[model samples]
Target chain A: MNPTACILVIGNEILSGRTQDVNVQYIARRLAELGITLAEVRIIPDRRPVIVDTIVAARAAFDHVFTTGGIGPTHDDITAPCVAEAFGLPWVIHPETFRLLEAHFPQGEFNAARQRMATLPQGAVPIPNPVSSAPGFSIGNVHVLAGVPRIMRAMFEELAPSLRHGTPVASQSWHALGLYEGALAAGLTDIQERFPGLDIGSYPFRRPDGRGGVTLVSKGLDPAQVRAAADAVQALIAQLGCTPIEGEPPP
Target chain B: MNPTACILVIGNEILSGRTQDVNVQYIARRLAELGITLAEVRIIPDRRPVIVDTIVAARAAFDHVFTTGGIGPTHDDITAPCVAEAFGLPWVIHPETFRLLEAHFPQGEFNAARQRMATLPQGAVPIPNPVSSAPGFSIGNVHVLAGVPRIMRAMFEELAPSLRHGTPVASQSWHALGLYEGALAAGLTDIQERFPGLDIGSYPFRRPDGRGGVTLVSKGLDPAQVRAAADAVQALIAQLGCTPIEGEPPP
Candidate 1:
């Protein structure tokens, strides 16, 4: 199995419903592509105490923890220092980060506002920022990145190569019309019991044509296990006398 | 202040980057408008244990807790029962909710999957779902709502008329152009200490012309206190020879 990971999304804008949290989905998809299991996610505000507590907890709980938001120069951006304090490290300006910031501006005539971006917690490694000069950093198992999805994505792309891969993820899903979740509940449970390593999920859908069905999803590191579980689901649907659709249409 | 609240966003799709968490931001903005202090937000997966633990923790910690997602009829939607387990309530069909469901699909002939939507924990009050027949419920201070933003928003709208409103929210803000965070640190700290009741926040802005500035925000129930603190901030900015923008523009 791939190692477990957790995501901590920090922003009052997200909690207050002003801005939707797009970065969590981006991170999950990326981690899946990299064969990592996203086990948990927590959305928190930019408050220093809460951020510090959650980050510390996630660090101890998960193999890898990724935090998004509050890394900017804004007053709401407290992730950097809060993270530093969590690990009992002093917040200091990193020389290399300053170099990157200096390159962005000419004559190295650094504005103090711009210099704020170079500040890092003591003993942290800078995560390259391809889109913006304001780089993210990593301390221990925690990867703190920008909340902006575009910049965060670019940073992840740069960082992915160096990270260790555990197991490659694979999934197979089947869907059909005129099927109820409860009717297939017994069979699905049986299939899950048979394929212990596979994670099976049932999602019901309502089509525009007023038809409804449940989509059976089987996911695991072993392609054979997922395929076997999916095949069993199809066979169970056939036994239930429903016209079994081979698989859900690709998104 | 009209009692504080926290929103917990639950879904794996959100963390996996497949879905965006729009509910948290919406709830926060609404609470702010209603003079309710939105303190924190936590997003977790569909996992039962995590859901139960989060609900339990939030209930003990916050005045009112709002949860979004995992209340649908699908198999993965286990939020309702998990909440029941968290609070030690028996999982039973709520009569009012059943009546609402029956009104929509009178004969239970709609589909077994549709009937699945009516299952509620015993002793839960139907929050009323205007958009859909699946009723959200409230047990104690925890308001469990749907994941769909449209339905959740509507449900809250229906529940709002009955909720108790306290003091109106008051806020004052001043924008300082191209002022570094460190340079204004002492002054901001003094302002915060001078106004104990006001929730002072500093928000930095990246100007379109490539300049940086911080907007200091203070929120409180006392209009006089808010005004005095805001005036002090405005005066401090003027003393520093930093131009303070007049009035709050479109955020």
Candidate 2:
């Protein structure tokens, strides 16, 4: 089975327009690069019950589940306990995390609020935060991360080396400015049939003057199949009387 | 009670980083302006079982649930039937929608693929798509919208008039230089207690010299409360011997 994963973005600030979420795209792209299929992403509020329910549901469904946000030092930062409850683990302060946090800010009292960041579920491993001392946690297949894009990227980079990767994923696309989707449907369908594993997407674009066109995307793990199907799509577009401009090759 | 809602963004393209899901921010900002608190946002893939389970879960949790993506004319567009299955509604094409779609395409075979966009749950009311001919649908309190940002925004604008709004939302913030969150914890907590309904967020900004300062944000529907809390935060920052700068008001 291709390792499928799901991401849960937990924060009301994100859904409330109080904060914009840029982490989803970053995590998704990184996961795809590592040959992990990011199957789903969920954004929920800071509510405990909702967060717990989503984590439980997503973890059961996907091979690996990742979460972002609500792991901060505030009243709304309830992700630790919620995730702990979801996995039936004990919520407690991890000694190693506490020491790391203490070393970072040794001059003052740790305080009840700041200490909240050190709490993790029983048997959960801490994902080191290079930017901030507060760490992320991983329980089984679920990797809980921070909401800040900078922190999230750092956490993912630290976590990536340990995760199991399948085939490296890649994608390619072809575009034409003067053709309609209906005009190329027959040919595109033939290309799609020839390369069953490649995901084919046709996005139609209409100009200000109502001129029509479509961009066909071919994505998969097999580089040979992707290139072959993309070439077929381009050739097919040429036969339809429209010169195809190939977009950026898949990375 | 204040009206509230949540958006569920479903697609592998979004999770895989192939497509940036702009729908969440669009819906969130729109909902916030309409005085509808967006409680959560979730992104799931095109899997039928996952979609069905999420729809049912979100429906049970929020007053109104809006879903974007997976309603297009493709094989991955499984949202329509999954939604129908979740609510136990029969999935079929509404006649009026078919007429509108046929009118736009005019002389072509509507075909099985194009016809797929016309299918929705029985008893579902069509949401008018001002931008595209393909219609969105509303069943009970759940509104199923297209995933494309331009299409989703247009469809939401059509549905906005019918939604029950409470109070128009507003927000304000205070910025300060050369102070860390640790430096103003006590005062920030005091501001929190003074404006219990308002949501306050502290964003730490690192200056060029490796020194950081915190930007305190106060948000709520009540402008007076926002102003009062913001003033208090500024005054508190000034007391810390840090220069307080007034931040721009929310747009």
Candidate number achieving the greatest TM-score relative to the actual structure: 2
Least accurate 10 contiguous residues by lDDT in model 2 chain A: A242-251
DockQ value of candidate 1 = 0.40
TM-score of chain B of 1: 0.89
Instruction: Provide the TM-score for each candidate, comma-separated.
Output: 0.81, 0.85
**Tens digits of per-residue lDDT for model 2 on A1-251?**
57989888887667777666788889888888898988867677767788988888888988899998878776556799999999998899899998888888867767667787898999999999999879998999999898877888999999999988888777878887887665677677778788888877766655668676777888889999999998898898899888888784221
Residue A35's lDDT within candidate 2 is 89
The lDDT of each candidate is 0.77, 0.81
* Model 1, span A1-251: residue lDDT tens: 58889888887656544455678778888888888888887777767888999888988988888888878754457899988998999999999999878887667446665576798899999999987678998888888898877788888887778676677677777786787675677677788889987767776666767677877777788998888888998898889888777654412
Interface RMSD, all candidates in order, equals 4.1, 2.8
Lowest summed-lDDT stretch of 10 residues in model 1 chain B? B106-115
Model 1 lDDT per residue over B1-251, tens place: 37878778877666555455677767776777776777777777788998999899989988888888888655567899898999998888666666666677646454555565677777888888876668888888889888878888998887766665556667777888877555566677678788877766665557567676876776678989999998998898888898888556413
User: What would you estimate as the lDDT of candidate 2?
Assistant: 0.81
DockQ of 2: 0.44
